[model samples]
Target: MLKNDQKVFVLLENNNPQVESLSKQLEIPLITQKQIDSHRDGFFLAWRDNKLALFDIKSPKKGMSVEFDARSMEQPSWPAPKTGTLAQAIGKKTKTVVDATAGWGQDSFHVFRMGYQIVSIERSKIMAALLGDGFERLGNQSWIQQLNLKSPKLIVGNAIEILQNLEYIPDCIYLDPMFPAKRKKSALAKKPLVVLKGIVGEDEDKKDLFACALQVAGKRVVVKSPNYAEPLGGKPDLSFAGKLVRYDVYFKT
Candidate 1:
């Protein structure tokens, strides 16, 4: 049975003593939920430890709906230009783009709106579920009803494991991995942070992810990084500047 208490607890598995200890240290209650038995065919309903949503165990590549209300509750100021933006750094000729680290599908959705076929890849199972739910709602919007635009494709798995196996080679590849903040004071409040923190922990293997992305993009790769962060691949051949962010562009030449 689900915990009825309003105060959230840190849910854990019986085998994870370290996690349980961490939960206790944080002053959060630790609750354990029963994992449903899988059928002979290897299918079982996916569920969250404390969350109410009935999350199906499916990769984001399969598709899902995101709540419009939740997306509306938070906003991130996207960089746009008077003429062209960082998105166009790969050039207007490019069509298909893959977001290698599609944490919450924000960047992927923006690229989809820009008349490109986007393949969004999110690695974490929980993040993928949230993204899947969001995409489901996004696909059925009234505006989508009038425009008849197809939804962006979603792929859930370690990007390093999936990118090289893709059947299609995208014209542009995009990456925006989580980076350590320069100072705790500069951190911005993002709605996805709480859930993502629980699922992703920390990104310790970004170097491997970058190598995989470099192997997959056909024409170019674009990486979004903070102004103070180092370039993704040494110095990019070209770069676009924003107020607090930068887009590093590497060409296939």
Candidate 2:
């Protein structure tokens, strides 16, 4: 269930069967573009340029989608070189990864493009639905089809429980749980993150989630956190730093 005070609806602007099906699948109300005025205070899921996008009521014209191509400007190649701080934290030998907190799935997709087999878990049904739609689009891409590559498997559930029950333990368990903003108001935060925070709230049980990851991961547990926040599990055995974020790694002995 979504947090109280957060209202979401599916906007069906046309008679597209797929969009209608998505509305039914999400169990959210299907509203037409004309009906936007009536639901002026709610967020909406709508198809834009054939891609499913999430739109805030305040800025209905501007929406965000789970985009794979957007990163191409910065990383012009497919399966981008595994040479960043993130890759360092994940380790060169890690082959399989479980993204235990796949909110918008950006990190999960990045790891997938880096050539690691990945399984993504998200507890929020709405986010999971968006992820499913994105992965479906990714599968239909020309390169993906040519290479027979599949998008990361998405599991809709609580990671704390799901990690314990995975059929095979992954080499690494990745955590990027949400933390409260440093300021009293989050108006300065990115629009997508602000909307996500409004919908899913914060990851209040990150400590417990971290403990579960440590127990389930075969090689190590890597946690991504804002630089200002304390390590989730006391101290990490190793830490890798990015511009504004940090990856804390706990190796399994």
Candidate 3:
């Protein structure tokens, strides 16, 4: 794994101590955003519009940064929570879920919006840092804080190790290990996944991750897969199908 210092640096919007504090937390070089123009070969974390974001230095001024927004009403699937594929897989009985591969955290956030306590585990510090920023933003909202909605806990480590050592077992273990898109080309290329793949690459120990989830989940383990890929957990006890994806459910016997 490439160290954050080797691949990422932090750029402050101005001279803010809070931004600097965030930079230190990421453990990468800190510089003013103005300095980004001269250094455009690697990734840089920048503060913009009151949000923490990841920017590629090469086109720092041209494109958007990775931002996670966890507000329930803002998410596309929140309106009909019970109808979503992830909600179906989780069902009403699930009390807690550990999202073992929280790529961009969409599924984990969805689970949280549906009222299930969720924990997100991402081995990629790049993703974890971005996810942390997102959760922090959500925590500050008056409505959320007033209602006492807790942000999903983020653990920056391999899920296999974290799962094996959890203080308490989760009702469901969720896995969405990265799989290449089934179709070669699509109208809307998923830029987040593209940028993520550039940072984290593919999961090489997917089978082992599934095995670990099976061992730790109290009630069941669920794996999300593209329609074209084989089930990650071999033959599942049940499966929930969606438009472009499916969830393989393996109940604990």
> Which residues of candidate 2, in runs, are more than 4 Å off?
4-6, 71-78, 186-188
Q: What TM-score does candidate 1 get on C-alpha atoms?
A: 0.68
Instruction: Give the TM-score ranking, best first.
Output: 2, 3, 1
Q: Please write out the lDDT profile of model 1 over residues 136-202, one tens digit for every residue.
A: 7677666665567656778878888998899988888898877666676455635354334434655
Backbone collision count in every prediction? 11, 0, 0
Q: After superposition, how far is residue 181 of candidate 3 from its true place, in Å?
A: 3.6
Tens digits of lDDT, candidate 2, 1-253: 3572238888776667776777777777887777887765778888778878888887788888887655542443566689888999999899999999888888998898888999999998888888888889887776776667888899998999999999998999999988889897856577778888877888788999999999999999999998989999888999998778999999998
Compared with the true structure, all predictions reach lDDT values of 0.63, 0.85, 0.76
Poorest 10 consecutive residues of model 2 by lDDT?
Answer: 69-78
Candidate 1 residues lying further than 4 Å off, grouped into runs, are: 1-84, 185-191
Pairs that collide in candidate 3 are none
- TM-score against native, each model: 0.68, 0.91, 0.84
Best by TM-score: 2
In model 1, the Cα lDDT at residue 143 comes to 61
Worst 10 residues of 1 by lDDT: 36-45
- Give me the overall lDDT of model 1: 0.63
Q: Least accurate stretch of 10 residues (summed lDDT) in model 3?
A: 70-79
What's the alpha carbon RMSD for model 3? 3.3
